[model samples]
Target: MLSRRRFLKTAAASTLCLTAAPAILRAKNLNSRLQIAGIGCDGKGWSDIQEMSTHGMTDLVAFCDVDLARTEMVHSLSPSAPIFQDYRELFAKQGDKIDAVTISTPDHMHAIIAIEAMQRGKHVYCQKPLTHSVREARQLSNLATKSGVITRMGNQIHSHAVYRNAAKALQTGMIGKVKQVQSWCQSTGHGKSGFIDRPKTNAPIPKSLNWDLWLGVAPERPYGLQDVYHPFGWRDWQDFGNGALGDFGCHILDPVYTGLKITAAPISISAKSTGMNDEVWPAQMTVHYVLPGNDFTTDGNLEITWMDGGLRPSLQGTHIPPGTALPSSGSLVIGETGTLVIPHYAPHVLYPSPDAKANVEKFVAEPSLNHYHGWVDGCLSGQQPSDGFDYGGRLTEAVLLGNIAVRFPGQKLEWNADQLKVTNLEAANKWLSRDYRSGWKLPETV
Candidate 1:
């Protein structure tokens, strides 16, 4: 699997060539069309440009958003793109008319606008808890594998079909090994709980809001009044969101790390929450993680956990059926031979006992995927979409290292993930990453 000229001659003899690699991975033109662009266009960025322009092969043109009145319904639907308010001036004045970009903003300007639009090779499509720490989700998943572009992380329910039938029923064993998973989400984000500090009144910024480009790399605050933090309640704040398990742990643990490929690096992590303060996040939480397992998990170890405000998980002994409940934000798994569940985006049941339930119904009747046209057909086939960004940036840096174990609640933390570090504290390796707004930095390569 290392062939890309032996991963650039073994990353040019180690130090991973200092990082931001891709100087060229561009491709597009597979019959012309592409040219898209649209970063933070409006709520969920105009619902991800109305699902990436319903796959008409793109051509949305351009449209950034630092809130020109939230670009009024994506300028009444594309209306000749060109809306800019700074996505670094939409790539310093339309970087060659863009070929890909989606970004949905606000998670602290997702790794500096996807590391400056994948170092101009373009093709991004970020969203979800893609970044906003955990070292910008491990440097935008190693700069989307050193900028080969064609990335995707808007965990749009990882292409719903209830998570491709719970990632094809736990990678085909139809839920057999999977040591223990459990998830949740029912509250926080409207159920309330985040903002606990910093908003000692500043207000007055709104005149169509641009409050310092919505506090770009954070660290500068002021506007706090429409239920604290900017428009979408800034997820609930903590330098602009990462709460609610980094706002829905990469969408309910993306089928427990894409049906258990898990990509290692979680020797531990812990939490218990409902306490944090220095500026929000913690109404109810739980976390946990563990990982380090493989062949679909069992004795090798795997755990997981999570939870959110409504805080659930122990349905007494399991079976269910008597009115079957437990969902608000789902994912259960369990498995030795059966459990499953799912619920969040719906349908995935399977119990096998209490008078039979099963009903997974084949990856939810197949033919579904359109998560923003699967990143516009993976940018015209350079491929890499099922939540790409090197597998959704290692499930968003292990769900933002469970928000640094909810800032030391029970204090487990360990991780290492090939030196992305945090090896047992040093103040949990200073929450992985921060410090951007002193005239903003990023760009150590991309």
Candidate 2:
């Protein structure tokens, strides 16, 4: 076993090598294995850790989770890997031992953890949307560029054959230049916890969980119950999550951005909701965005509409064969030649039988790549993958901007991406970033 002093020296040298050149050359190391840590040890985090472990070049080094009880699964996988309830402690003790981290924490903590990791020269594979706010997304993108570290967001479908094929089809102009798009999901914004407001009763925090750490960055609130705020229920809260648009937009709109090559942020945004209160997101909503057109677009700008809570676009003008139904969650792209339907994580379909058949014959499918292993490979080789923070931050910025629109229903908010603010509404600018609690504030510098 390598001594602590020698490990630190070697890790520092490896990190320097990674920053000095492109990742095509492998990092200097004891072996080919890339040391990795897993934060948030259950739910999506467990799956992420499990998949990454399958990569022969990756080695699990440590684990961290706010809830200790939820960490049994990971502990069972790597008995010798020490577990910590706080990520900061994990970094303090094992920073030199880790080469990369897989962050699958709640939405609010993603930016805070990812930024710190990158600043320390650690590669990151974070879950999407990359951050809770637009400003955080932009900050992450800028930091990733300056730090020169491998980074990838955990929208795994981006590597799947269906989405890869869809992106290629759109780029190849299989349906001609895109005119408009309609994307939606059947999920509601505030039902995960089955409460629209904070529960009147305060339940005792679990003995194995660190309540304070679980509420990191988010405003302090009473622990409602087991399924209220922790263990997959935070998605329904405004303080910790971004609601349906934030949950599904990064996923369903991924092909739209990839295929159309949309790098610029939306110019304007507006929204309407069924109803809402200060406590949680609205149950249903629709958001509209106007963005600058790229090479794959037909006109000056492309309009995209997003809906959730079972709301969908009217298929009146679409080329669908009259009585066909749209997917429960997916996107419909209207192009000059015909229409394309991209179902979430499923095969994409083209409208008009003749056009569909002709396009299908010419289309060659792209093979699915292992998203987890791809990040592991990138870390060892110093090569950043396609969904890295640079791309994910831009994609996440657009997704989170829709949430800002949700706050001001029926009002159009003009955006200036360069300024990272809403030009028309001064009040709306505050939503671009959030106020972190004391002691949990993000570093002002990279």
Candidate 3:
């Protein structure tokens, strides 16, 4: 088993070789023409395929999904590609032929499929939040390192020029001694409590869907339309998803964490909800994170507030200084000198008066590249990806901690990052890991 230190050293060495390859030699190598496969071929997965194709070197070779209809739909986009309903079979049969696998599946299945691919010597790109549980995130990161595979988390916004600029600006002290961060996702979907469970209904599974495979690492459960497709709402269920915080927190809070170089777990976490139930949604929910004060010595302390599902910070009380449209879903950084507001989705923007639109004087704007291709390019050339497993796992761990706070709403939870456990809440600590179904054990060290 590779120790964490050894794994990082190997990854760094591999990154050097990948990034130093000459353009002429790179173009001539057929092995460099990345043959890729897609799992969960609808929504983000479908779009990722299109984005990857634009890189000119990617060959869309296979598509997999529990829903046959989804696989067929994706096959239309790449008619020559083979299709499979089970990802395990797809990986086993075609692992060697493909250079990488892109997992844009629901949050729960991420670790199972990604770990399998990495063990088979295939690079992987799994969507964020990287895993359903904190333990899964750690395992995935460790496995990627052990297998010597290049990996990326699908927080695509991280590749945006503005996000990189935001980090650079903060690093250069453009934000001037940052102190507090406010991140939010104004979602109406998971209002109060997240997804309500379907009553014990024996609804027949869809003919086109393979129910067992969809459940993957989650506990075995009978299928329901509510559980599977249409409205595509599995995100609200605790069994297969992480609700709103898990969905948007990875993308929204990532920039702030990255710019700040926050690696340790929060010293404390607390949450409140307007709507509470046996299930996960709090209607509107707010989570507060008190990071260790030592990370930013100049700033006495830093706090990150996560708001979602109709819960949000009041613009009136915020320091935006009026006349500015509050960002619907993004982050607000309160620095010693001024504040910066960034948008949630694509085309992340910087804010506060003239700086919001003034061509971002210190930054460069360039056409966006596909995050999947960036990983492939990095792998083949031995360059480090911006959101590889180590960084991705950390980001996922941070966001998932917010989910843990929701699970133990109103409790002040203390975390021990080195031990990877919640120190103050014994009940909450139980959720740090999960039991995989039969035949689905994560490697002990990887």
Candidate 4:
């Protein structure tokens, strides 16, 4: 992490830290392209590789996925690229050939893959909610700082023009001094919490799927049908996924963090859930945070609340426009002047309402950016990404903390950021991390 003085020095000099890290790998000549590898080459990984490999500076050289069916599709794209079912084998064999990697694996597997890749001097573009646990988030951040590797967390919308304008508007004071903010997403996974039971009878594992490789660092569990916990439904599981708030908090609250310049963890955080069991996420969750605000907020204090599972902020109760209806998934910014309602990645709406819906000239005037290419270029040029691990780790830490608070619903947990502990509740601190199953223990140092 760059110190405050270094940041100021760079800003005043109108320059960036373009010097390559000591561990960075670059061609002897400037004309060579980057050799890239895709881990979990399906779903988001498929799209990430599609976009990134299209860049003039990238070469898709390797693909890794637990499912042969998924790799078959990616294989057609880069037919010459080697394929592997396990990332460890891929790293061991192709370390010399790969320049950087894009990791889109499940939450539980992200840290180990990223750390191993980074330790070998490879840059990384990892998917969101950076890790499965808060402790891992902190560890990854420290490793990134120590290794000085180019890295980015996959919150793609962070680079979009809409979100960029929202952040700019706050910095520009278009919305006067934001005192409070509310963000939310639909609760498909959370709604399933009422029925907190896993399938007692294990379905036959698919021949096409490598269940053991897919499990990775996650504790051993019987594989069920894809509908239960394989391809998509794992988001509802306690062991494999990071619930709704864990999944979407990083993406939804990104603009708020950027706009308000939120640099520290929340002073305190707590949550209340309708009812949650060990099997699934809660049906409903309301997480509250008292953040240490920056220049964009009032008096160095701000209150931000997150809701899901058929919950929405009350615009009528707040300073927002009267009789306003909430969107299925979006954020509401409450300021002294008016409110700014952003519906996910779409355009933001201002309160007291703009006269012409088309008249957003004061808002967005720039073009959207390609997030995948930005990371690729950052690796090649030594330019730090906008949503790099330094920022993403802090955001992930807060989001994971909300998950911890959910375990002890209706109880406040005071955070000691510097110490990375729950100062008030010693018992609650245990939820920050878990003991890795035998072969899954994380190395103490990178």
TM-score winner = 2
RMSD of each: 19.1, 5.9, 9.6, 10.1
For each candidate in turn, the TM-score is 0.35, 0.92, 0.85, 0.90
How does model 3 fare in lDDT? 0.71
RMSD of 2: 5.9
What are the Cα lDDT values of the candidates? 0.74, 0.84, 0.71, 0.79
**Candidate 3 per-residue lDDT over residues 1-446, each given as its tens digit:** 22346334323322111112111111112386888899888888888777777777778888777766566557776777767767766765666578888998988889877876776677788898899999889888877776677889998888776576566555655556677788889874344233465555567766566676777777776675543433267776677777778888888887787778777668888887775555445556789998875443255667899988755565553447567677688888766555667777545444444343333475654555567668878867867687999999988888888877876778899988888988877899888888888755654442
Per-residue lDDT of model 2, residues 321-342, tens digit only: 7678889999999888779899
Candidate 3 residue runs with Cα over 4 Å from true position: 1-30, 188-195, 199-203, 226-231, 293-297, 315-319, 346-367
lDDT of 1 by residue, 1-446 (tens): 11346233322322111234335555454356788788888788888887777777777878767656677777676676666666775676677777888888879888888877887788888888888887777877887787687888887877877777677778877656777888988877333433566656665775555677778678876676775666677777778778678778888888778877787767888987768767777778888888878898888788878888888788644544556677788877777756778877887777755434344454435546778787787778777766788787788788888877778898888777888887768887887888887666788664
lDDT of 4 by residue, 189-254 (tens): 544333367777778886556787778778888886556777767778888788888788998999
Q: Which 10-residue span in candidate 3 carries the lowest summed lDDT?
A: 15-24
Using TM-score, rank the candidates from best to worst: 2, 4, 3, 1
- Estimate the TM-score for candidate 4: 0.90
Question: How are the candidates ranked when ordered by lDDT, highest leading?
Answer: 2, 4, 1, 3
Off by over 4 Å in 2: 1-31, 353-358
Alpha carbon lDDT at 15, candidate 4: 15
